[model samples]
Target: MPIYKTIAHNSQTSVKIWKITESYEDLLKPLDLKPKNLTRVLGMKSELHQRGFLSIRHLLREFGYTDQDLFYDGNGKPHLKDGKHISITHSFTFSAVVVSEDFVGIDIEKQRDKIAVIAHKFVDYELDYLNKIAENYVNDLTKIWCVKESLYKMFATNGLSFKEHCLVIPFAKKEESTVAWIDYKDKKFRYNAQFLEFEGFTCAYTLPS
Candidate 1:
């Protein structure tokens, strides 16, 4: 499908999402990265992950960046030589990137009923708020999952628990514009979180302050 979307909040920060529609081998030719690396680390056996990475690289190109401009920190966070903070995410057939002059993070997830089963592992105070909503709102649950995932990516650490550390205010069903915050290590970071439905997946991006 080669579907792509970009959101420029301002010149300092922007987000891009791409859906792969090309062959995996053809997609990896430009970057020349080892396909095995993604397969080994992400378990991306199908062509989805390969094309997703290609889409990510293409998005970087839109910003005048290339794979050479990309590097990873000790914590595995992608960094650009110009000192702009970056976060990358891929789920199934989609990949996303967010960049900013300051710290930033972005995450995309496939909305599924399975998230509800695992909600306890990453949802806490948010649960109480979610419970107040009617039981038939599956879309609401998906938004909560995306919000927490975005928060977790923003934190980008192992010790933080989404259930205990992340909190998202309830929004109307299928709401795409909302604000949320995360409290980590006694530091409170606020974010603007919004959701978009793309090919049965829910993508969320968080702008950190």
Candidate 2:
């Protein structure tokens, strides 16, 4: 499928999602991948990962970018040659990319019960409001995870702990947006978080507030 959804969050930032329904070959044929990216994709052992990687490149195309226009820093954060901020994520059968003139981060997660088992590792302040027995427990955890993951990507810094450094302000399941913070190095950074759910997957992204 081509661009399952596109969110024009504003004039300066946009999010694009791709549902990976095509074969690896079909995805590869149209992308003019950088040689290193081609090698990396070919080196991937899982077909699922290869498809996810290719699908992200397709998402870039939708944003008027090519593989040659993208690069990564020492921290492994993606950047565009034109100086725009970019974040990319893919899981299972879905992939997404967010690009903006300012810093931004995005993440998509497959809702799963297993996340509950390790929630303590990445969840902190959120525990105050989370009820493990609630019907939306797993889904809420997924949303929190996605939000923190985006914050992690946005910072692109080493030694950042999700539980210690990030917080997702309380939000009901029905709300599409929320507030979040990163309290690191004795300073705080704030972001406006937006999220959506479809096909048992939850996606969240953050932009500077």
Candidate 3:
């Protein structure tokens, strides 16, 4: 297994990334996939998506887990059988998983200019501080998108609007940590969002303290 990166977040939380270099057949041969997942993986029309899905199982093995230990809820949020919080994401050539003792979420996105085109769909309150002409505009937008996605996975509440319910605090690229909030129903929630840029990919994960 090609484990690309690992973050030992405070001993209790872990983030593992896998670079998908193995062929689909090569990855499939080693997986301990349940029948449901096996069918699901084989049914995927995109080869990249199939590999990404398989690669997640590889990430699980890195954390001492197997497909049998994972389950998805009605909202399609994944949970570990041992009760540890879990979040998973994959993009293009990479797949990742974040496991933490507290409620957690994670996301990975390829930095692309197209994100700027769709910025208005998910960005609202933070636009006040964004610099559209800056060279980091795409990077900034991508980070914000990842933060909101991470929160969406964490909150796991249906009908939560990314534009209205999720808000990422402003921060420069040099800053590794920032705060995010989710306003839904009658309650508000806060998270310490952490992000990193690597290999042209931006990954963000959220944890509640």
Candidate 4:
């Protein structure tokens, strides 16, 4: 299953997703590369991860860009020479990227019940909100996980515990939008997030205004 989806939010921003299920070699073919050559070039642990990386590079090509067009800042944030913001994420079998004229963040998480057990580790004030729900759903938990992950990616700093510093407003099951905030290093930043369901996985993207 090679799942690919692209969203053109506007002229200045777009997103691409690649869900990998085929052999690594087949996926590489679409990018004009040979397996032997890619193995040497990427040196990734698995062909799957290599293909995911290649997918990102291919996306850049779509925008008339290359790896040289990207670089990490001192804060470990990826930036484009053209000053566009980009976020990258990869799960067990999925990869996604978001590029925009302003700061953006994205996260993807495989749905699992274990997240509920660990919720206390990264969920605090939000617990009260989550408990208000009369019924529990795995999809609901996945949504919260994705939202927190998105916040972590956007903040990208150490010592900001999900339960302690990050908070999400209450939302109903199957809700598509929510407001979240993070207070890190004494600065608070808020964002509006949107969620999408993709093949038993939850993905959330946030844009800081």
Candidate 5:
């Protein structure tokens, strides 16, 4: 029940983050989950993952939704039974959901120095402004990863490369918002992105621009 933060992005879109501090049993005790989802959670080997999954259901309830109202398509993108857009994400100690009236996506990632080691895999244009020696290098990389990840969730398709297809416009970390583009299959899509940091984690969410 620890909803760490909530962002009313606008009248039609909202973001909710939950800090996972409860045992899996305690988190599951108050809700009813669909059989398949229940099986999915129970089958997870990591207690952390199970708790994250259950805590998401709690978040859905906050948005007036139940587990039964959620489903995924063949693309593995989550959908609401009533036709709202939904995106979900979770890291080691946190989980979040973003629901909107338009195409939307969300992601949460823990800030870690190791992200620097893997930055080459998903970084391209942003490198023009990134300084590897800067004090906030890891923090910036983490935000870029979260933005690209949110783009991936919104454009749930095969063959989209984070480094090659997604581009984030330059912006200072203090700005907390930017524009991102997905150039795939010879077509371009635009989204407005916003992000924040809490407890050493970064959470980013996007909506079609």
Candidate 6:
């Protein structure tokens, strides 16, 4: 489906999303990949996952990057050779990448009631305002998960617990953005979070503040 959306959040950050409707073979034929990436894709068990991986390469192409230009650190955080921070995510049929001069993170998730059952795993302070019985429960849960996941990607540090260390400030369902903070080990960092919903999926991203 090509690039489903592009976000120019500011002069320094941009994000691109791809709806992966192409077959694995269709996606594989058009590109050149580093041998490791080819091996990585071939090692994957699901064609859906393979397509998602390939589609992210295409998303990189949209920004004038190639597989060789991207690499992961020991912690699996992605970085571009040109020194930009990059975050990647793929779920179900959608994949997205965010590149920015400042630290940034992005996540996409399919909305489902299944997330509610596991809310206690990654949710804490957020429960203060969440109404488990309301129609917004699933959407709300998904957004908070995405927010934590995005922060996890940007911070890319181990031992940061979503339930204990992250705090998502109260936000109504219709608002486009909010403030969040990470208070871990006496080092505090804050972020500006933004979100959107479409086709039963919720996407959230965070930029360092």
Best by lDDT: 2
Q: RMSDs, each prediction?
A: 2.9, 0.6, 0.9, 3.3, 0.8, 0.7
List where candidate 5 sits over 4 angstroms from the true fold: none
Worst 10 residues of 2 by lDDT: 123-132
lDDT by residue for model 4 (4-33), tens: 788777787787887766566665666644
- Stretches of candidate 1 exceeding 4 Å from the true structure: 1-3, 32-45, 131-136
Q: Per-residue CA lDDT of candidate 5, range 61-175, in tens?
A: 9999999999999999999999999999999989999999999999999999999999999999999999899899999999999999999999999999999999999888598
Compose the digit string of candidate 3's lDDT tens values, residues 15-122. 999999999999999888999999999999999999999999999999999999999999999999999999999999989999999999999999999999999999
TM-score order of candidates, top first = 2, 6, 5, 3, 1, 4
6-51, model 1: which lDDT tens digit per residue?
8887899888887777677667666644455544524666566656
Q: What is the TM-score of each candidate against the true structure?
A: 0.85, 0.99, 0.98, 0.83, 0.98, 0.98
Clashes of each: 0, 0, 0, 1, 0, 0
- Give the better candidate number (2 or 4) by lDDT: 2
Worst 10 residues of 4 by lDDT: 32-41
Model 2 TM-score (2 dp): 0.99
Candidate 6 lDDT by residue in tens digits, 65-114: 99999999999999999999899999999999999999999999999999
- Predict model 2's lDDT versus the native: 0.96
Between candidates 1 and 2, the lDDT winner: 2
Model 3 TM-score relative to the real fold: 0.98
Candidate 6 wrong stretches, greater than 4 Å: none
Q: What is the lDDT for 176 in model 6? A: 83
- The worst-scoring run of ten residues by lDDT in candidate 1 lies at 32-41
- The candidate, 2 or 5, that scores higher on TM-score is 2
Candidate 2 per-residue lDDT, tens place, 1-209, comes to 87899999999999999999999999999889989999999999999999999999999999999999999999999999999999999999999999999999999999999999999999989999998999999999999999999999999989999999999999987999999999999999999999999999999999999
